[model samples]
Target: MRLTNNLLFFFILILSLYSQPVQAQSCQELETWTRLVEHEFPSVESKSVRSGSLIYNSIRFNLLSDKYFIPVFGKPFEKVGKLKKFSIKVKLTKCKKKPKFPVSKRLDWYMWGVFSQERAYNDAVKEVVLLRQLRNELPSILTKINSPMVTNDDLEDFAKIVETKFQRLLPSEINKLEKAIEKQYTIASKNQLTLAINSLKKEEASFDKLMIISKFKTDNELLLKKLDQDTRHNFFKKLAYLKTKTISELVELEEMLLPNISAVTFQDYAAINTIIDRFTTNWYPYSNLPRVEKLRNYYFELKTLLIAVNHREVIQQIINTNTLQGFKNTQEAIFKYTFSSDQIILDIKSAIVLKYRQLQLLLRIASDEVQSKSYSMATRKKLLNSVKQIQKYERVSIEGKNLINRALHKSQVLCNYIMLEELKKITEPFLSIEKKTIGDLNRLKVKIIDFKNKYKTCDGEVYDGCIKAMEGIEKNYK
Candidate 1:
């Protein structure tokens, strides 16, 4: 009867406390809470449970001063495995209500360095979650920041605000994280450097080939040739354009590295420049030839012949001795032309055409292997040299053709300069014969273009057609 009366009174008291609304604040009394559990609770224990499960319990409190300490229990001991209660004496302080989330700039100042140095395990994990959430949000916030500079001072304030809302990090963990970030940056830098080196090498090769094929080495004799005012102007204008192209290419190759100055060094730039200087020289300008389909067709045939002959030579060498002596002999044969100083330049031009053809064949087969990045450096270099030689021959052959055409054009122009004494002696004006000769030469050029497009060689069909077409053209004037 007495127990029943006491239970009724206790029930009434719990109902009275439960009627009030709970208001969260900096500190609150613990006694105002009503019990949810109907049964007795297990006590905090030091010993291993018979069930082999572990449990932890916590109670929080407000600090006694602006900065203060209170004793709180810590971890358990291993010996005896008995249930034991402990009193841990350590400094414990309250954090500034863990600051309202999505804290403003002003709120950050209020929370700075206000949290204690220690954390309960659960609280530390919550702090880490809070930090990560803020870090994720920072990018957008940083973008919106109105300051001319989001200075280091602004960053420091942000750090303090974040730190005070979380448990303190140990020194060792901070060191490990810094090292990991540094390692990532280092790896990225090295990859960038390697790609740059390879791309630069390829670009250098292209520029080098341009110089090798270019006719910047034109002799004084050609430069000193008497040209009309219009011809002289055209020649100088073309030369200027060629020089501009060379400068543009150099600027482009050097500009590729400007963005990577922090990662690549001056010494690396110097090495690249030295390589560029070595491979390319100057391009010889082509004369403003008339746009004739027959002439262009012949040029295509010339290119075809260059490639086919080179391929045949390579096969022959492989089948022959397959020895270095054979290669030496082949090289000797390519440069075998003998010419006297007073000899026609046409005779000397033939040797270059032969060498160009051989190199063209080598490049046709090897270019794919080089670009695939599967060949040795030495192999790629040899391939590039062949391409350079091919370009040289192309330029040389065109130059030869232009020189012959120019001589023919000059014969017609020279009649205007002939004096009265020489002019009266001739039965016909020299210009008349030269005009007829140019028409005959143009006809021969057309036949040459038509023949080679099908036959693709200067011999056989080319020889027979050429002899038949040109017999009367040269004999009348000679």
Candidate 2:
């Protein structure tokens, strides 16, 4: 009976040891105890069991104690083997009690062993609920931020969330998320830039093309500053290629339009001038190009052509002038200030020579009329006036003066002959003196003989005899 009582006491003591507060032992010490159990008991297998009855629980290791030997005094000291096995429950309690830092995997397992099945299931439910909440909210936080392209503002918002709310996420994990977002952003931005560059190809106007390219350059510069260095590299290279291609297209367009400048008429002066100015300004970088140079040359040539056209108009107006002096003044002005092209100058010179030839022909025709003896005094006088009128424009050519002077001399000679004939007709009535006194008879015979003799030598002295005979008749008759 005393032995039974002592056994009962010993069992109660073991129970008391098992129920001791877990704070008395460190987690490492508890882990060491579990290891010792495994090492010492070869045949006893340990089963881990966890409890979650409360917020904090113990880890229980169910171990089967192996059959052990007992010492007994029978005749002599002897060893006896106990055939019975005992189930032992080892508890590592409070292991998961709110730790200051994260628990090690082994320590976590030790703590988890203590939870009850119901408590573990409740804990799982809580975790699953929390995971579901995070999953649902995560997409809203990440995906809703600038659907395809994430801006600096969106990135800033993400940074703020990471700093304030997602601080628990590892830097590597956060970096992966950011990279994903940035990839989308890069793709979207690249698409936009590519589309814009492609749109530029359709542009027809030089000014509009330059304006769009200029603006795009500025916007791309600003956008590049926001992108990471790695992102910037591909974007820069690709966009630069696109930019170069667009600029090349613009240059080609300008080259294509260059012929229009040469074909431009006077009516297109203002519009063409604007084109020239724009090309000079925008294409300055490519000014060394042959096509660009041609554009420049064509512009100035157009200006020169304009001057020549206006000069030709002036020349045309002058050609209609009645006097040579008007043409002379205009031609002088053209030579000094207006004339530019070789073609126009040659044309104007030819026109002037033609006018000179026409005037010379008229003078020659009038001069030929003076040689005709059938011409009346009135007709001879009219010829003299026509020759004198042409003489006014004698400066039209070098040969004009000589032609005019010869024509003037011929017309004057004809006038003299006609005047001589007129004077002879006036004297015919006086030549036969039927009722004459001796002095009158002598005067009449002298007058008739003198008039006849002078008229015959009129051509040698430029008709001086006609002038003298007229003067004597007027003096004697008066």
Q: For this target, which candidate reaches the highest lDDT against the unseen true structure?
A: 2
TM-score of each: 0.18, 0.35
For each candidate in the order shown, give its overall lDDT on alpha carbons.
Answer: 0.35, 0.52
Candidate 1 pairs with clashing backbones: 208-279, 208-280, 211-281, 211-282, 214-282, 214-283, 214-284, 215-283, 215-284
Off by over 4 Å in 1: 1-13, 24-478
Please give the RMSD to the true structure for each candidate, in Å.
29.0, 23.4
lDDT of 1 by residue, 209-294 (tens): 44432443253223324344564565456545554555456545544643443243322433433432332222113222222223
lDDT of candidate 2 at residue 203, scale 0 to 100:
62
**Model 2: lDDT of residue 96:** 41
Error of 2 at 434 (Å): 88
Candidate 1: residue 14 Cα off by (Å): 2.1
